[model samples]
Target chain A: MTATRRTTDTLVIVIVMLLVWQALHQVAGSTALPAPLPTMIYLMHAVASPRFAENTTTTALELAYALVLAYAIGLAIGVWMGAHRLSGVVGEPILVALYSLPKITLYPVVLLIFGLGISGKVAFGALHGILPVALLTMGAIRAIPPVYLRSARSLRLSPWQTIATVLLPATLPEIFTGLRIGFTVTLLGVLLGEMFASKSGLGFLIINDMSLAQSEDMVTVAIILFAFAAIANALLLWIEHKLHRRV
Target chain B: MTRVGAIRFAVIVGMIGALELACRLGLINHQTIIPPSEMASTLVTLLASGSLNADIARTLGEVMLVIGLSVVLGFAFGLVIHALPRVREALDPFFATYYAVPIFIFYPVLIAIFGLSAIPIVLIGVATAIVAMIIATLNGLDRVPPVLAKVARVHRLSPVTTALTLQLPAAAPYLFTGVKLSVSYGFIAVIAAEFILSPTGLGRDIADAYADFNNRRMYALILFLLIVATVVNGVLHALDMRWAERRSGGRS
Candidate 1:
């Protein structure tokens, strides 16, 4: 579709959805679901509020810290396991098992170990992301074509030289795929931590509003969170697309 | 066992033994880290009490329902989206971006509407899973070889007949991938929703254990969940490999 056509379609869909929302609210006649106009206005107010700002910053900071830890540790482990036959054999099954299992099961354990704080959230987020990153990175490295290896060997490239000039470039796409998933899972982990137990953050705000039956406030926070996730995903996707094009 | 399998088994055993030893030696707090031995005993106790059985049945039922509904709905939605190129193009970015968000945040709204029942839990699971299935189905459709379409044209097959006979079978592998993801991720979302806010199921048991400060039960439940997830994933993976082999054989 043309860009303009696509934009028009999206606009039409959004308008129709808003109309449906309003219709439902009117039909239900429930205070639980305020009208869309009011909800959007309330969302704007929530966004403009200093409290929401603080919460957004807090959640973003926690996510950043956790992603950094997850990326660094996961990358290192993936590289080591991928390159070494012994390590790969010993670690691949365990890592894959961990990756498949839901990491939310460990939230309470994290809370116990780290306590209910940003540290606990960060720990959970990192745990959530680390396995996927490590697994994907390992897979990417292991998938390097045998011909590439043979050529590298014939060229007599050192380990560092081979990694930098060949392996890194070859695996960049897969690595980015892993990173993208890692980033999203990290956000989920932090949100889980906040919801389960936390002093502050978007998760906490949403949960708190829900408990208090602040329907408008709850919806507003939810929208804000969705917007944040959407933006972050788009940004990462754009970067990945650029990298893929370059390669 | 294969050499790699044996090595991996040893690595797991070594880690468990190390953890047990650490707990026994008081290096690791038992309250925080319930050793595998204790967790096993707790699991046995729960089994004897029949609570574990009940929880397992409830959770399994909810997860199955969610996965079944999502798979059907998502595939249908995917087919419609694929048929309508304009709609697919328009909504592609939204779907892609939506996948990244933790849709669990919507559980509250679900609760308000469904009012603390299995409905909310199932809805949450389906919502989380359906998108992945839709994406996978679309991807599968896209992968149907152009030659198949040409062959269908040569046969003068109706579009519906062509899609049903030629395209869907060719896309089965990708569709199965979506099913696998939906099942696994749906399981996760359901359990998480239960854990977060629900009255029954394995999640409730875990949350109750947390409330009671029973580390053993908590660890036991987590361990059981891990085993279940691994088994489910393993089964799906085996089926996927078998399907690939059969599909290749059929082609040959």
Candidate 2:
């Protein structure tokens, strides 16, 4: 797979996929499988909408708040659970149960509790977001060998002192994995909540377009989401890489 | 057994019981924080009325279809990539990029392609699953040390034979891990897609409950959702443990 061959391979896959789409559209009709050209057209129309910008910003703001809050809460719990076996036992299963559950199923309850506002999105996002970080953190902390802790204890280090000097430094790399997973999930939570129930947000905009049969606008909003995800992931990856390199 | 597990179960149940009693005793707003007793009644009604059953069945059908297709296609795709070393290297970055790109972003695209239907819901589920499966397979390939590959070459082992014997078994741990990961993510992806894009199923039922402000019913549904999560997780965990034992040379 040289660059040229890679390009050809990609092109072939795309062409074949598009051909299949075209065939499906021809057979099933536009109501079901609207061809690529129409989708692209709809996306172009959607990008030109003033409301799209505002909605996208609203979603991003909610997502940011959720991610930050989840990071803080999950990191604290995760570190504690990781450092202590008792806490891990009491907490880890709960975290997993929460994470494994169809979080969207909680959307109704969240909506009732938080109302349909940015706060609701943030709250729901955090609920969906925190478990991964907490689990990951607990795991990383647990992975640190007991010998290091014993050595610190032998040196008569205080609990806090051991955590600060030994565990913290040793587990920083693994802890970052929790952060990365937590952030990605926070975004997903925000997006899903917004899409399902919101007055403003990129997800809401997409849903709105769909209802109005504005396929192009729906496509555009989708594209914006794609761009947002790309930027967010790249940023997280860079941060993770930087931290790893520094340590 | 783990004393830790026993204690945790007690603690969790105690918390639930405490919360239920407090709400019942008016230590909290019973309406806002419905007691488990009331929630359980609501649950009975929902199940009796066939709403939960229908919703779960509908959602499960779509998810199962997606999982079935993805497993088959994913394994095939993995095999193809393994067969073509250069192609695997070339596709690696693209796979990583797509994997990092959250599948929720594609919800709108799904709707555009399939409308508010189960097809889009299932397609996105499969898509979310694909990257993880591929990664697991690729990771399995890494278990074949370079030395082993060289030896295999010297001994003239067919690529197919080498793959069936060495690569897959070596990859079993990772593949199982990937399965666990994919199922969980796939669960969320399907529900989220349906919640956002489709007009039916569990997500819709939950959303409708919110819109209607039926708190008791909502609480009931959430409890059931929690049950589903716990059961699925337990199953996955048991499977992982079994595989781990077998993989560790039958230490169990």
The alpha-carbon RMSD over the true interface for every model, in angstroms, is 1.6, 2.8
Please give the TM-score for the first chain of candidate 2.
Answer: 0.81
Worst 10 residues of 2 chain A by lDDT: A27-36
Clashes of 2: 3
How well docked is model 2, in DockQ terms? 0.49
Model 2's CAPRI class is: acceptable
DockQ of each: 0.61, 0.49
